[model samples]
Target chain A: MIERLKDLWAHRELLWNMTVKELKVKYKRSVLGFAWSFMTPLVMLLVFSIVFSILARGGDVQWYAVFLMSGLLPWLFFVNSLMQSVGSIVANPGLVKKVYFPREILPIAAVGANIFHFVLQMLVFFVFMLLIRWHFSPWLLLMPFILILQVVLTLGLALLVSAANVYLRDVQHFVEVALTALFWLSPIVYPVGLVASQFPKFMPLYLVNPMTNIVLLWEYAIYNPHHYGPQVAYISFWGILITVVFSIVTLVGGYYVFARIERGFAEQI
Target chain B: MEHAVEVREVSKMFKLYHENVRSLKEKVLFFRKRGYEEFWALRDIDLDVEKGETLGIIGANGSGKSTLLKCMTRIIYPTSGKIMTDGSIAALLELGAGFQPDLTGRENVYLNASILGFSRKEVDGKFDEIVAFAELERFIDNYVRNYSSGMYIRLGFAVAISVDPEILIVDEVLAVGDEAFQRKCLDKIDEFRDSGKTIIFVTHNVDVTREICDRVIMLEEGRIVRDGIPKEVVNHYHQVMETEEEASEQGNRKIEITEVRLLNDRGEETNDFYTGSSMKVRVCYEAREPIVDPVFGFSLDDYRGFTAFGTNTALKGLEMGTVAGDGVVEFDLKSLPMLEGRYLVSVAAHSRDEQTVYHWQDKLYQFEMKSDIDDVGLLYIPCEVKTGPQAG
Candidate 1:
């Protein structure tokens, strides 16, 4: 583990280059380019607001657009990274076969690119809040830590999927199906309180889902600043801990699997 | 003296999975996992090279040359055995494998060089030299996707040689660059050889192996068949090639080779020919029915299967016509331009469309280069060089 860390540290320049190159290629030749990053979340929030408001028919729920944006922001970053990283190895089979670096770099490139988009969308999120009557508080200082958690969690899953893709090309399809199921399972569209009222087991289920903690942390920081207290801190800490453990396990396993079959990749690919 | 590398009975086995499980049910049940068959790519390979020695590995395709190089570089773990090496190793296995096409050439230099273990400070010091070597100073800022194939190799090779590695492992990387670039790379390799770095060179060109290596190791299938001086190992490799060809002829495939010959101007069989010598090659076929077109191509390949000179009768607008019972067909070469080496002649018979292959033969006849000392490369291109200050 330490050796891998040392290698990553030694090759820090490569990581930076990979991230920058990823962002460039993604936005290149597009009509709107990076603006589309902010536009996507805004559009999704507007549609969800209109649909949810009609479905509720004048409920006690306040600021429906803000509520939906909180979940939409983190969900978009996580799901987009998960979907793209599944083919990270198979798509760049030439790079994998020819070079010997941390194979994790391939998946991490996607995560980094998605994180860039997520940050752009966050700027739009703040713009919407300023347009309304909400106040930006001291809790906004912790947004960077919350964003790091989302990155770690998403990258950990990306590593596992990219490695599994070498043996099972169907992991790409499996991830799409799995993400659809996970979308409703998480407290994205609705609050945990609403789900807990009917199914009392939703609290444990929510805590088990790493994104639940991540999304709630985002909500506390962005929408409900007063709610940022010891409970949110405790959840963020555990989210970070889980992310670290998961990322390390996947990184090591992926590296070993990659090195084991590294020779045959040239012949097979 | 300390040894630079030690390989004790190192072998690599690959488990080839032909039918990959695609569905969730099959993958969960592990149904298709049992179909994998294990094949040893390298077996009981043992050798050692002292510091500053250049060891060349020569073998046929699928003979484990690249596998052995990979194991030595620790790019791939061996299935069995162990390797002990000293110092930091840099392996230039594939050209531009570490490069990102979407990234600029300048960015790729730092990215790929750092991946190979050089620091930003180190690369910065040699940045100008590397660009000068590749002759891409103008395109440095442009993304690598815009670079041509030659430009890519030039930059890739430049980064590889610029790093002062203690041990450098190369595999056919020199085969792609242009003549000038290849000369520059060879000079750099020579500099590395002069320094005390252990170099393991892998190539299918026997002449390259003989020119650059202090020792040569020959591998057949997965076993080390011969190891010693380059000339001795190459002779053994040629002898084995002959035996293997004879063995394959007796196999289940029934399209047999009856006779092969090369004729002179008067149509008499001769073993000697010179550069620019107009020669006739006759190949006798013994099939019950006529083989149309038959491709009837022959290539003068060096001992390592690197083709030196090759052309087909169909390609030269000479149709072999039709042949029934037993027959002989001739290919008249207008000019044979090849230098000194033990070159093998390979022939193949395909359909008129050249899509479906009917029969193929390699190393059917071997010839020697009898050209002048000034001749070079796979083919001898006549040229005159006047030195002593270019007419100033």
Candidate 2:
């Protein structure tokens, strides 16, 4: 495993160049260029706010638009990276056949490019927060740590799906359906308090989802803590710890799966 | 000399699917003991290529030449045995393979160079040299999608050559681009060779193999048939092709070439002739039934399988109305203008209308031409030069 890391480290320049190629190629002819990255999450935030605000009318939700945007941006990053990286190996058959490099670079580069968009969307979100006159907290520094955890989790899933899709193309479609289902399963538009109040028995199971903790962490750092209540904040604190452990496990597991199947990639792709 | 590459009984097996099970549904639906046919693309082949030697591999399509190169380059793993290489290897298996059409030529150079395992600093140093070699300096900033196919291949080939690899594997990429660019690439390869790099070239052009290779190997049906000096191995490849073609020939049984002979001035059949001497090629044919106005033709090929001269009786205005039974056609030349080399004579009989070919024999008869005068080239043109300054 250390050897594989060293191999990948040795080819870090290739990974960087490929990531740039992805970013450049994605917005090559578009008039707005990379503004699309910031615009996509903003647009999703608008649609979700209009729908969810009407649904949660006369409810105890404050600044639901800001809450939805924060969660939706990260969710979009996760889904988009997986969708693009799943086909990264199969799409670049020419490179896979003609050249020799770490096969994992393809998927990792996809994740890297999407990470750029993720950071850009965050910057845009921060500006919108300032416009709304939101409170500032030193705890906002913890967002980078959460972002690192999210990156690790995203990389693990990207590696798994990208390598799996090479052997079984159905994995791509499977990921699409699974991501859609996972989107509603996690509380991106709705508050976790509603789920906790409605399904008291399943609250623990619901909090087990890493995204639950991720979204709660984002809301805690960006929004007022009283909105979440002390009890919800207590569970979210432990949820963050569980998520950290889960991220490490997934990352290691994903790396092994990727490495085991990478040898036959040249012939299979 | 130490061997640059050594292959020890290397073999590769590929699973040939009747239907590609690209999806899980098919794999489950057609669950069986054996889902695919096994194909051994490379047999247990052993080879040792010395450092600084230029080796050529020649074979018919699907004869495993490319498979062997892939194995040596580690693009594909062998099922059995082992292969060892002494230094960094770069292969031009397919040109411009990883190029993104939407990116500019300059961006693609960096992308492609890094993919070939060059560091960013290395590419920056050689970037100008690569563009100049490809002659794409003006269009470097333009998107590769706008470049012509020639420019794409030129850039691809240029980066591949500029990497300064210790061992280079070229597989027919030079067959693309214009003739001038091809010559330039070949010159670059020659320069690499002079720098003592090991080159393994796979090409169908025999003249290229003769010009560049120090040794050559002929592959047939996943096995090496001949491995020796380039001249001898190429000759063996031609002979094998001729025999295979003859084996597959099924004539219509109208007229069959019974015997073909090369005769000297003495009118005696001989396999040897002297340059600038009178020679005759006699072809005898037997007609199963009566035929009309059959055109008899013969083509002369030099040792490298290049057609030197060819003519048909019909083209020469010879009228043969009706022919039956056994017949003979003789083509006589005042002087054989070929240089010292082995040559092949191919004879064919066809209707004067040129629709129905009675029989066509390729490389049916072989002959040797000897030259006492020292000259280099395929043909010897008789000429005398008398030069004086300011003759006018």
Best by DockQ: 2
Q: Tens-digit lDDT track for model 2 on B1-392?
A: 26999999988899988877788887788779436889988898999999999999999999998899988887788899999999888899999979999999999999998898888899899999999999999999999999999999999999989997999999988899889999999999999999999999999887799899999998887888889889768866776666556433335759998988889999988988998898888889999998988899999886456788899998899998888899999999889998776777888998987789899887767777878977777789877888889856
Model 2: per-residue Cα lDDT over A147-204, one tens digit each: 8988999999899999999899999999999999889878777877788778879988
lDDT of 2 at B301: 80
Candidate 1's DockQ: 0.23
* lDDT on C-alpha atoms for all candidate structures: 0.74, 0.86
In CAPRI terms, model 2 is classed as medium
Worst 10 residues of 1 chain B by lDDT: B247-256
Q: Which portions of model 1 miss their true places by more than 4 Å?
A: A131-133, A141-145, A198-203, A225-269, B26-33, B242-392
Q: Best candidate per TM-score, number?
A: 2
